[model samples]
Target: MNIIRNPKDVLSGLLFIALALLFGWQTADLPMGTAVRMGPGYFPLVLSGLLGLLGIIVVFNGLRTPGEMPTGIAWRALIIITFSVVFFGFAVRPLGFLPALGVAVFVSTLGSRLFRLQTALIITAVMVVFAWAVFIKGLGLPLPLLGPWLGGY
Candidate 1:
């Protein structure tokens, strides 16, 4: 008589619950006004509550169902993707938006099992162009194409 079933669902539910708690705590200081006059924390608090509720539901479902544990984790993809995102955040100021984004996208693509250099390059190029169009041109943001490290003021 196994008490725990569907390990994947339980883990996912726990993750969501943890995120909900984090966000909720972070927004606790902000003012939450009335419905008619919403404040900064209102939406975030609502979303957090919803996330917690969803997590509870998922956990219950997992407990009710009978399923096997997840086979294995994709450590390479996980590490690469996480590293690329952190790198982009840190490099954005020094390397600028375009270069940082390009490098991050290319490196992230390498995390895929079927990754190819050419494919990664193409994806990086497309993402750079799209970001430039949408964020720089369309939104009229002040982000430079190249930063101090690349000597683009």
Candidate 2:
């Protein structure tokens, strides 16, 4: 009797479509130039279109086939990861990019059952170094390694 055979896929497809529409709407004001002379909005609009197309396909497929519902959620991991993100957002200005990112990455790793302090430390170090290389040195973002709280300019 249910028209939607796969409820999860249908819901996810709808979510994707909604996101695509929202992004497309936001990008509408920006000028989209020709392919050869691409504008700031060009790539985003193209991506949004692709996302919408994909969502349509997913919805059709879901309606055509049956699928089991998703298993129980990973509440612990979800909570920890969410907390880490919020902490990073709040701490970034005071702690600076490197320290905030490092702490966030490390704390996020603890959300996993296979968490190891040594591994988390290594990941934190690598992520901090990579972020510094990409955002600071390569792209020349004006983020400080340390903030005013830590005597950095």
Q: Per-prediction TM-score, please?
A: 0.60, 0.63
Model 1: per-residue Cα lDDT over 11-103, one tens digit each: 888889999999999999999997767788987999999999999888888888988797899999999999999999999999999999999
- TM-score, cand. 2: 0.63
Model 2: per-residue Cα lDDT over 1-153, one tens digit each: 989999788887988899999999989999999887778798799999999988998889899999867677779999999999999999999989999999999999989999998999999999999999988997577998998887878
Q: Which stretches of candidate 2 lie over 4 Å from their true place?
A: 1-69
- Residue pairs clashing, model 1: none
Clashes of each: 0, 0
lDDT of each: 0.92, 0.90
Q: What lDDT is obtained when candidate 1 is compared to the true structure?
A: 0.92
Model 1 misplaced stretches (Cα beyond 4 Å): 1-69
Name the 10 consecutive residues with the lowest summed lDDT in model 2: 67-76
Checking candidate 2 for backbone clashes, the offending pairs are none
